[model samples]
Target chain A: MASRILGRLPLDEDRLAQDMARLAQAPAPQEPYEVFTIGRWVNLNLWNASGDDGDGFFNGHRQVAGRPTRLLGGVPYIGELLTTWFNTELLTMVRARNVVEWSIVPHRDFLESGPAEDFFRVLVFLEDNEHALNSDEDMVFHMRKGEVWFLDSAQIHAGVNISSRSRWSLCLDFKAGAGFSPGDVFARAGDYDPAIRPALVERAPAPADLPDRLRALSAVVSRHNIKDIAFLLGKVHFTEEVPIGASWDWLVEITRASGDPALLDLAERARRFFVHSREVYEEFSFVPA
Target chain B: MASRILGRLPLDEDRLAQDMARLAQAPAPQEPYEVFTIGRWVNLNLWNASGDDGDGFFNGHRQVAGRPTRLLGGVPYIGELLTTWFNTELLTMVRARNVVEWSIVPHRDFLESGPAEDFFRVLVFLEDNEHALNSDEDMVFHMRKGEVWFLDSAQIHAGVNISSRSRWSLCLDFKAGAGFSPGDVFARAGDYDPAIRPALVERAPAPADLPDRLRALSAVVSRHNIKDIAFLLGKVHFTEEVPIGASWDWLVEITRASGDPALLDLAERARRFFVHSREVYEEFSFVPA
Candidate 1:
């Protein structure tokens, strides 16, 4: 499936409490400086390359010294739950992300991670955050606590947590065996719940003259607001009827109208970096000057 | 008398067309650099100190050499209209403002404009813009073409033009005589139409925990989005059930949460400037560094 709910994990309050306590004490490895984030979005790794608890940066399992996945020293509850509820041998990387009053800009993942069939991604919400939302290219959705979603990260997507409380979720990346299918993995892992369904968000239709309306931003676009405008445009896709790439197009138009060469150049580069191609550790800043 | 519609001007399409043509060719004196503006909000003067059309900056009539208002060299149509419709002897300053996809941040005006009764402010819409809105401390409203509004600029207020089309309005300031009232000026000027009533906006009540929700911005506040956040906060007061000053309080909280000393300092200064005291030509920038 491109992006759909896989199953629901059995809610274990005791285990969840323990995991929450452990995560609260865990030190965030880094403050991500990438274009995809706009707030304090932190990540804690439970399993990844080097097996170092401090190594929270994303490194594909194949690119590191460690041949396969290894459980980090800390976060025993997450490790136990993963190993018990899923086939840990097939897992490549597992991270617990915490977002509080933050947003992840619209982006696609795994551009260079080989064939799409070789990769499998799953996101599991750890708590009920009414104010959180996740948007794929097609639709905006809300995932409840204990929901296991098979996320097609290869597609354009974004996330937002607008609440004062934490929106904690687990991101797991798996490597499929030769000619692997989701059913085979589910049978082996015994984690599938066929009865569970995803909850989708309903949004009002975007105005017909949205492009013309959006061009109005050009009159106000400036260095101080380049990123905010980008974020706002990115959000319009999920909230309105516009396509994900439409935001970048609007950005280009807005910056060009600004009559500022630097902003114009930055908008063009941002369009490329965000929708076209982005390398590991490559960051884009609106005010590079 | 606080913030209400004074009357409706007779719609003269020919004069409006001619004015529009002239305004299109007229050079904008300056792009306003103040806490109140966020886009290309331009003002052209027809009457002011020095009687120079090029002198578009705002200097209260009393502050300049010309005790009363003086017609500028150019823009004879605007000067003629003001002279014919109102008592020019009592007028202090007259300006034509054009806003396209721009917004004036929520702010209180006439903080030092002497006694409230002595100063009379009127705004006349030159065209119909569906996306335009004006908000006072109490409510948001829309003014149609040829409508004349008695604006109490002393109260907290803001303006927004979300359309790509120009939102042009005439700002007329008058220095009232002793024991003055809006009735006395209208009787003297022959500009009042008693039948017109202001169309007030209907808004839902603000959420109970809006302050808590606003504080969430602190988690994501940064130099790149400080102004956007401030503007967003400013707009919220107009759109939601929050007081005008609440935006500043939220700004202060958001900046303090950012842990950025520069942003924090700017927010405090902005609070003081926009709502409290502002000297002539004083400007505020979100990203001064």
Candidate 2:
């Protein structure tokens, strides 16, 4: 799985800081929550499918439960700003406040059951501290304040806070049919003033398990998975010390045996470019001269 | 054009060095030669099509012109060593001795006319200095003593001796149908003792002219040139900031417009892998953000 930085939001830092300070001074959670084994982290649901303040079912069509009395406290500026910035039909909005030294277990959302298409989860960091969102394939995103990201919820991810002070973030879930995508956000982010634009750092994921992963993918060959599997084979050929002939042979044999013309064509292209020595040498016998 | 380090040859370095020393002490070239305006370098033809001593046609079947009178004068070790090492039917042989502070202009070999297939030119460096052979895509190979290389004659290449000491190398041409290839040599090179293996340094070629090159290739769409043109497009897409979508779009349009299904399939495979962001972003407008 690959994750990209969609871009940053343009929120006035001074006003956001003031709003956060006011929210922090509010009288605790307006509703009770269950404690977990890791630590005590509180969730304030601003909107959900059910009108109640309790943590409601997190999927399907949702409506604004009620006014954000605990944080917004009848204030209209922040709500208007969020509604305008997101520019979509809001399904659910939640303020997740993580206690110091606490972390959420890695897990995927809306996997077992969900709508036909995938939805987007946009995160707006309220306070800056040593907190990170670790996702699939060991990708870590150290989100900073005033930054916005469209997190891929299908991938297993976790939110962690190891700062001395508590951390807070606003997570907004928009309906998949809202006609918004990460690509749009990414392009829009580039339009922001350079001074306040958030930095997007993408780390190349380590391929320690690539061999095993490739083997697994090859075992279950299908049209949907063939492209990715072929790409991985090319990646392995170029970046690894594995013999080029061996890789070419494997791809040729597997794709041919699968009897998929597309895969076979892909294999041919892979041979032409990724696998060197295809053009110059017909048979590369290792006999020393 | 791309060049690969096919492999290394095994030779008795001590005996070869002794023969080189004996050859160096010899008076001068045993045959007549021509001096070019580029530099003071000289060519001594050891063998050619004609029995007379002169630089004859460099390709096709040939016989030894005469004895290597100056270097191999009464010395059988070097001749026997070369005959045994090459171990194939020879077409032509020449002793290229470059004077100090001289260079050869960049050019391709056998471009005007040649056999149906390409021939191999094996260079055995008799004396080593700070000399280099620059070839396709800015690749440079520094030939060392007792080292043999199958130079890619079809690509533009040049030899340079920047050092004050004169450089000498024996050039041997072998029939391409002799069942020897760079791939076979490259695979076998790994078995050689690491110390004797020549270093192949590849420099990144500037892609400033890539767009123009690609345009020219698209104009002359032929089966013979399609593969190379596709490979170059892949190279540009992977290594350059040119948007992958743009590349895919151009390839699809050109190959389809050319009415070549094979090229179209090749373009499809290219888009599947080399052109990233293909599946993610559909409409990649080149407009900034």
- Candidate closest to the true structure, highest lDDT: 1
Per-candidate TM vs. native? 0.51, 0.31
Candidate 1 residue pairs in clash (backbone atoms < 3 Å) = none
In Å, residue A185's CA in model 2 sits off its true spot by 7.2
Writing each residue's lDDT as its tens digit, candidate 2 over B1-289 gives 2443334555676876676565454333322221110222444455555533333344343323333433344345666755555443443554545443334333345543354244667676766674434333344567766666667666545554433355777676655545655433222334333334446644444457554444433443443233323323332322334442354556666687667787777666545433232221122111111
Candidate 2 residue pairs in clash (backbone atoms < 3 Å): B6-B185, B6-B186
Name the candidate that leads on DockQ.
1
Write model 2 residue lDDT over A1-289, tens digit each, in one string: 3444455666776777676665554322322221110222445555555444444345433333323434444334556566566543443554545443334433345443354245667677776774343333334556786677666666544454433355777776665545654544332344433244334335444356544434433333443233323323322322233432444555666677667777777666545433232321122111101
lDDT per residue, candidate 1, A111-133, as tens digits? 54455567788888989887688
lDDT of 1 by residue, B1-289 (tens): 4688777767568866877777655545533343466544667677776676556555552544322233243455665566667766666677778875467787877664555566778898988886678888877898888777888787888887654466888988777748766754453445666668777767658878777666766654555456667876776655567776688888998788768888789899988888888765565555431
What does the i-RMS of model 1 come to? 18.2
After superposition, the stretches of candidate 1 with alpha carbons farther than 4 Å from their true spots are: A31-33, A61-74, A184-189, B1-228, B231-289
Best candidate according to TM-score: 1
